[model samples]
Target: MLSFILRRLLSGVVLVVTISVIAFLLLYAGGGDIARRLLGEDASPATVAQKASELGLDQPLAVQFGTWASGVFQGDFGTSWFTSQPVSDAILSRLAVTLSLVLGATVLIAVVSVALGVLAATRRGWIDGLVQVVSLLGTAIPAFLIALGLVIVFAINLGWFKPTGFVQLTDSFSGWLSSITLPVIALSLGGIAGVSQQIRGSMLDALRQDYVRTLQSRGLNRRTVVMQHVLRNAAGPGLAVLGVHFVGLLGGAVIIEQIFAIPGMGQVAVTATSQGDIPLVMGLVIATAILVVILNLFVDLAQGWLNPKVRLS
Candidate 1:
């Protein structure tokens, strides 16, 4: 198990490095006239040259990447070209908001999807039909549209939550929950639908296996057998689906944040990209890559735990 963990950690590090390098090239090399944009269109070529040189944009790609990566190792992500905020500060300050949304949605997806999946698989009647209907609706509707509907119904009509703007947890825990409720629901609906379907399918397959029949023949408690063995086997595929949904939640937050006026990594990412803030963009990319790696690592560990026979090496 220790070796398994170590191997996953090593692979995660390599993945982060590879993503950072690719993102660096895509943003720095392909991104045009960043210094000029910062200095404004009217700035003289000499002034732009001075700014580029100062920012080390004039250096060869290898040298620039080396310097940036070195600084990153020391916890310096440089300053935003436009805002002049430390890139790390800009990202970290907003990271919490995005994490809150994604994490909340993830929990909702896991609990609700699993329950619905299990019910549909076991009951195989109206319950199954209901799950299918919900899955269809969730898959059919766009998240943004759902978000808008939620705002209209829950926020505007019922006044259940604030339609836009985020509340910090430090300010008021209840308020924080209230602010995130609609957005989390919007983000999780599709995930729940997809994951529940996958879970139902996997569980049905597990139930039909020879072991399930053997357990029944041995007069084992049906609930125990299904919960302990069948569900365990089914959970592997469900977990894989959940891991993917987590990433989707992160991407979906971009629109959700914009619609709801929440300050998060998504909002920062959009602003940084539009303004051609390479340092901030690079920082966001690295941060996202690291987050993805960590999430995958957790998923791998969970997978290994659920199925000991899974070969980590």
Candidate 2:
């Protein structure tokens, strides 16, 4: 298990480095005049050149990357070219909001998916038919549309939740929950559809295995055989789907956050990318890469724990 974890960690390091380098080169390759944009359209050519030189834009790409990479190694992501805020501070401040939505949605997706999938796979009657219909609707509907309908139904029409804006958990737990409820629901719908399907398939397959019948023949009750053995074996694949969906949730949160007016990385990432704020954007890219690696590590660990074959492999 330790060796498996170590291998994953090493691979994660390589993945982060590769993502950073590719993002850095692509942003620079665009050849956008960052200094000129910073200075404004009316700035004289000479002044723009001076600004570029001062910002080290006059140096070769390798030198620029080396300097930035060195700073990253020292825990400094540098300042936002536009905001002048430290990249770490800028990103970290907004990260909580995005994380709140993503993580909350993830939990919802996992629990609901498992329940619906288990029901569908085990009983497979009208309940199974209902799960199938619900899954289809969820997948067919867009998240933004769901978000809008939620706002209209719950916020504007019913007055249950606030239509927009996020509340910090530090300020008020209830307020935070109320504010995020709608967005989380919208963000989780598609994930629930996809993951529930995966879970159902995995569960059905596990139930059909010869070992399951063998275990049942050994005097194990239905619940005991299903819960202890069948569910455990099915968990690995469902978990893999959930892990991938978590990444999608992060991305989906961008549009949801924009709609909800949440002050999360969604806003920061959109603005930074559009404005060509390399420092801020690079910080975001690196942050996202780290997030993916961390999630994958967790998924791998969970899989290894659930199935020894995974760890051995």
Candidate 3:
């Protein structure tokens, strides 16, 4: 297990570095001089040259990347081209908001998917049909459309939640929850749909296994057998599906954040990419890569824990 974890960590580090280098190169190669963009297209060539020199944009790609890589190791992500603020600071400021949304949505997905999936697997008729219908709708609809509809119905019409803006947790826990509710729901629906379907399928297979029948024949109650034996075995594949859904959630958060005007890493990523803020864009890419790696690591560990047969190495 330790070796497995170490291997995963090393791979994650390598992945982050590779992604960072690729992002840097892409931004570097992308046309439109950074200095000119900063100074305005109308700026004189001499002014652009001076700005580029000052910003180290005049340096060779290798030297510039070396400097940026060194700074990354030292916890400095360089300064944003437009804001002139440290990239780390800018990202850190919005990290909490994005984390809140993602984490909240994850919790909701876990609870809803497991409950619905288990119920659907155990029950018959209308309940199973309803779960299937929900799964179909969730899989069929795009997150942004769901978000828009939710905003129109719940926020604009019912006034159940604030349509946009975020409140920090430190300020008011209730306010934070309230502010994040719609966004979380929007982000979670598709994840819930995917995870529940996987769970339902896995559970059905587990229930049909010989071990489940053996457990039942031994006088274990249906619920106990299903919960203790079936769910555990079913969770492995469900977990793997959840990991994939999580990556999707991250991508969806970008669109949801924009629609809701929430201040988050997603919003920052959009702005940085659109404005050609290379440092900030690089920071976002590396940060997202790290997050994805970490989440997958957790999913791996969970699967290994839930099923002793899963060989981590």
Residue pairs of candidate 1 with colliding backbone atoms: none
lDDT of 3 by residue, 1-313 (tens): 8777787788889998888888888888774588998889899999999999998889999999999899999999999888989999999999999999998999899999999999999995799999999999998999999999999999999999999999999999999999999999999999999999999999999988999888888999999998888999999998998888888888889999999999999989999888888889888988899999999899988977887556445
**Candidate 1 residue 51 C-alpha distance from true site, Å:** 0.7
lDDT of 1: 0.93
Residue 217 of model 3 has an lDDT of: 89
Q: Model 1 reaches what TM-score against the true structure?
A: 0.97
| lDDT (tens digit, per residue) of candidate 1 on 107-127 | 999999999999999999999
lDDT of 2 by residue, 1-313 (tens): 7899999999999999999999989988675887888889999999999999987899999999999999999999999888889999999999989999999999999999999999999999999999999999999999999999999999999999989888899999999999999999999999999999999999999999999989888899988988888989998989999999998998999999999999999999999988878899999999989999998999999999998889888
User: Which portions of model 1 miss their true places by more than 4 Å?
Assistant: none
Deviation in angstroms for 286 in model 2? 0.5
Ranking of models by TM-score: 2, 1, 3
**Against the hidden reference, what TM-scores do the models get?**
0.97, 0.98, 0.96
Q: Between 1 and 2, whose lDDT is larger?
A: 2
Worst 10 residues of 3 by lDDT: 304-313
